[model samples]
Target chain A: MTNSQRTPYDGIVMAAPVTIPYVRYSIESAQWWIGRALGALVAQAGIKASDIDGLCVSSFTMGTDSGIGLTQHFGLCVRWLDTIPLGGASAIAGLRKAARAVQARDADIVACVAGDTNHVDSFRLTLENFSRFNQDAVYPYGAGGANASFALIARNYMRTFGVSREDVGRIAVAQRANALRNPHALMKTPLTLEQYLAARPISDPIHLFDCVMPCAGAEAFLVMREETAASLGLPAARLLSTIERHNAFADDPMQVRGGWAMDVGELYAMAAVNPDDLDIVQTYDDYPVITMMQFEDLGFCRKGEGAEFVRAHDLTIDGDFPHNTSGGQLSVGQAGAAGAYLGLVEGLRQVLGAAGPTQVRNARLGLASGFGMINYDRGLASGAAIFAGPSR
Target chain B: MLQRCEACGAFAYPAREACPSCLSPDLAFADAPRGGVLLAETTARVPSDVYFRERVPWRIGLVKMDCGPTIVAHLHTDCVEGAPVRMSLQLDKSGQAVTFARPEGETPNMADDRQWREMTADPKFRRVLVTNGRSVIGQEAVVALKAAGAKTVFVGVAEPWRPFAGEDLLRRQEGVEVVTLDAADEKSAADLAADIGGKVEILVNTTEYVRAGGLLDRKGTSIARDEIDQAYLGFINLAQAFGPAMRMRGADGINNSVAWVNILSVYALANWPAFGAYSASQAACLSLSHCLRAELRPGGIKVMNLFTGPVDTEWFQTVPPPKVAPRAVAQAIVSGLKNGLEEMYVGDVAEEIRQRLAANPKALERELDR
Candidate 1:
């Protein structure tokens, strides 16, 4: 809790299983998946579950009742707990929360996790069902899922942000190309602006390819005091700083501009860092539109210059700023809760010199984010976490 | 194309005779703009004996008109939930209804979907099943699911069960499983419950049994059946059979107990029907939901009920109605189940009910003939 330079705490260990249950998502599965993943991490790190002092989880489908209840079910003896409800942003938020707990001496070791139902039908259910966002103003208007609604926002974003339809397509194309190098990516096909634009639009500016595939999976990590991490001989990453805010219905009242993008500056400030200091960054990208906005908001490049960044600069490992080296949600296969964690894991591995192919060279610091609860016409609820290299 | 009524401030699809709000005969036709969010959509199955079996599992949607109104339009692609749709003037194949397509950058051409095909075709997999009543859409969804290579069974729920009956429809679809239960009484409910003692992967309850006819022809009046208590029996019976069956199965499988789908007119949820008995019965059905949810949570059951409005069925066809379709209602219900929802309000009526319930708690009692 210092100025621009926040003191380093302990190293955080993140872990997760690669697979998502194909069946419909349920509370039991959520707890099961999370517990299994965490158990593996505990064994790897050589720590007892009870010895872990804090727990944090993020999931779109797991409600509060289910999230809190999972603690007892998982048999985690922890003094602190945090449940994050943002869609793709959950993992990053959990990390930040764990960082705080570690810094506060709330716990010596913290576990962060995510999970979801990978079933396509259930994906359909999550959208058409009485979602947290669409219970009222949306369903009656035939605004189906986040894709359709975000398309509307993307349409307006393109208009307001001065991004050409090609620019959006460019992002999709580039991400797909980047995903090709990552084996875990869902989409690896090389894409072009022509192919992107030629594709049929699900909504105005949003194309089918412009959105990430609905995936179900989980990811996790462990965070503990730096001294303890080294003493245990565990690989680690530094949690620099974090921040979270809820902007429900920000667009409805027309009080705010760019729901998720609105607070990029604030997020950077909370982390006591700027977009410039990061060697790598991971934004919770359920859609390409949100991805572009993250760049603009996070100060990676400039506002409405996201498309330019993709086209002009190289975000690939060989390029200037490395992004979604794991192919991101676009290619990385978004398994809901674990997706963000996957990004964080990849980031940590890069910083730890562990990523085999998708690694950003000489990576020392990384920033991760999660955005969720697409209320009204925008995504107001978001969480951000900044991480630095494991102190030598 | 559908248009919003100048009088009622609501969207109307297929152009209607009068404003459903005010009895104004000043109906104006308007085009449903392309490029609206897909609020909800589903696929449906047709009997082989039916003429449109080839189109059996097709996609249809409750599209929001960019202007204001909402219409049930055909979803051209296999994409149900997140797929964006561009409204356009197309032949309403079903009954002069308008349709739309994906706009530019909306969807990739079929050939470009090589990766999607490769991913979908894997045997070990992850797959999602989305239904459409139209065979074209249904086939597309199936193709997509198959291409994803996930073990998927996307069943299309058809509309109008009375004339053909749910059992008869189940009989026609070979290799498909069926859970039959009456939507009107207790004995049938018990029988259905016994039949489905355990084996069930996904349990969806979409049975609505209501004796329709205005309670009062005039501005306000009362009708019987409110005291009869027959309607309540169907819901309870079906829940007993299916809800428990899902619980018995695996906690991971989805259990959707959808009740009160597209049967209400404006008076039902809000106006406080003149038929107090019917209203009371339906209200009671909704009340039992809380307890069932609590009891089933330990079993990992995800329960969702549909509080839907009018649907275009044999019942609605005979009576004048809004731009409602039976197929549309079915699609929405299935979509809700996919998102892991607990409750879904099909149309604007849900909001109307909330308003009435919050604004005037006693407004529902006005229908009582007391």
Candidate 2:
């Protein structure tokens, strides 16, 4: 899918929490769980399997055939389909793929799904599947999984971006605080920077709390027309515009040239909106460093200023621009599919004024971004969504 | 000899590896009792987590030693304290040492009372429901709701699952009917709270979980998701199924009294995973309990999440547990309802988690791993 003449979709729907039994299987089973959950969600929306004209799914645990399997499992017959294989950024990629389908009029409705409970064998899965492509760069380090990979990313992010140990501590600490309010969240205990710093370090600048638990859970969503959404008693949050960029082969730091700043002028022009127009923002927070860097890339603040932005509590609900109001993956315990779908849920909730305790008052416009495909040093995919509230 | 650190006031186990708390190298061993009253404890349905799944259906708990330091340990089936109990820390063939117990005398009379025998003997008792609100209460309320006659009884819990402690509650309250919430998931927790109108008669909220540490000592890695899954599933699933029955019974002469039992701890407000997920999940369940109290009130169902610090149960082994007992904690929870108290404090630490929740949250980061 090329980025040209992308039109904003009227509304978006996220169908999730579709359960897939995966405790007994390998990580690949997580992909099947994702397919099952997404299939169930699309069926529940009363949209015929054949009516799903577009396909977008984000799965961290699946393979190339994973997306195709989603179509076959659900028996959705679509000619214009996309297969997005990014991990944490998979959902955002799917959303972008859906938006492109809508813009091209190739498909009227796009379905997005992500769910996995294949984390128990996550270490082995990474060695087998994740290392297949980056074996040269990753195998030499005996890198275990995303944790080991991100450990390196974190180490570099801290050195290059000037992020303090305290800053990393503060991120984990804040996530726990936010999670305390969410019942579905896995981790609800409180944490302090002092205890966080004192925790056994996995890699440099990364503590146990600094990484997300390899959890087993399921969640999925649907993207549809504004009218379709209203008919179902489901609230509608308008997607004004979207932009997708990839630097898959880059060796140098893409912090400055990543998706957030890669000529968003066209995206802004297409959406007819600016950075200051957003009220709530959901930047993919796989790691604290990615969160900070993406915050800058999306133009929330200047480059190299990501640390300053997060340090000021600017991303919390009480701040000027709240991010990840649903306690995020960091707080919600990182149920791969559910964690990614959270941005959409939070965006919809903020738009609908149903975010409850974490709602940003009078929120109208919001931005949700995702970063994924971490090889060793950085992310390969980043996608952003611009949503306008119901009041607008 | 087990002596409290004169400096930090913390009781040191096996003397000091530089006080786990203040980290002062200076420490002295003092005389500590070999046994004490049992504190809060739980019996496991299955062994869980990668490290310990092999040892299924074991009992793990906080036992307050006869001395001062509270510790966690694995207990044998015959282990009951306040009755005679011998403690031995043994290095197993696995090379890891854990404390064990051997009952030294007749079981405490409190453990073999009429109520305990009655509740434990009932075949239907396996599906006990602990309502965190006015879903069901004592004998009068239970009978009142039963007169209207619903097939199932939903017992609401104000906190997460502590099966062994919950059994203690049942033993104390004969024909004590209640419904547990089926809220391990998002929609079910909400549905269980919402579906309580006419079917449920008496709503009693036993809404507090036990905790021993503040923020610092709370260990995140130690507590796994499988444990949380088992605990929540065991508790909430019963609550969800019990709701429909209560709705069917609908408004007999059931008394609706909400109880928020408070236990004591200082960082109940601060972020502390070391104290365990039970605290935070209890807080989440407490929030749901509070919301249900308000939402289901019109439907004639009352909700209240209790906040209690710690209790003395057989759960407490020589490893150290809370100072209070099961009977005492049960009495406090039951009395809170009978006396029209909305929130009850069973211990000091229970109140601390509540106070922490009531106050502004501290600046803790959301990131756990990098």
Clashes of each: 61, 117
lDDT per model vs. reference = 0.55, 0.53
TM-score of each: 0.52, 0.47
Distance from true location, Cα of B289 in model 2, Å: 72
Q: State the RMSD for candidate 1.
A: 16.5
What are the per-residue Cα lDDT tens digits for candidate 2 across A311-356? 7765566766577776677766565654566666567667767667
Show the lowest summed lDDT stretch of 10 residues, model 2 chain B. Answer: B115-124
What candidate 2 gets wrong by more than 4 Å, as runs, is A1-28, A39-53, A60-65, A75-80, A230-233, A248-257, A337-339, A354-357, B1-370
lDDT tens digits, residue span B26-119, model 2: 6776555667544433443321232223333334333556655544444555665335455445322122334444455655542233212211
TM-score of each candidate's B chain against the true B chain: 0.45, 0.38
Q: What is the DockQ of the complex in model 1?
A: 0.03
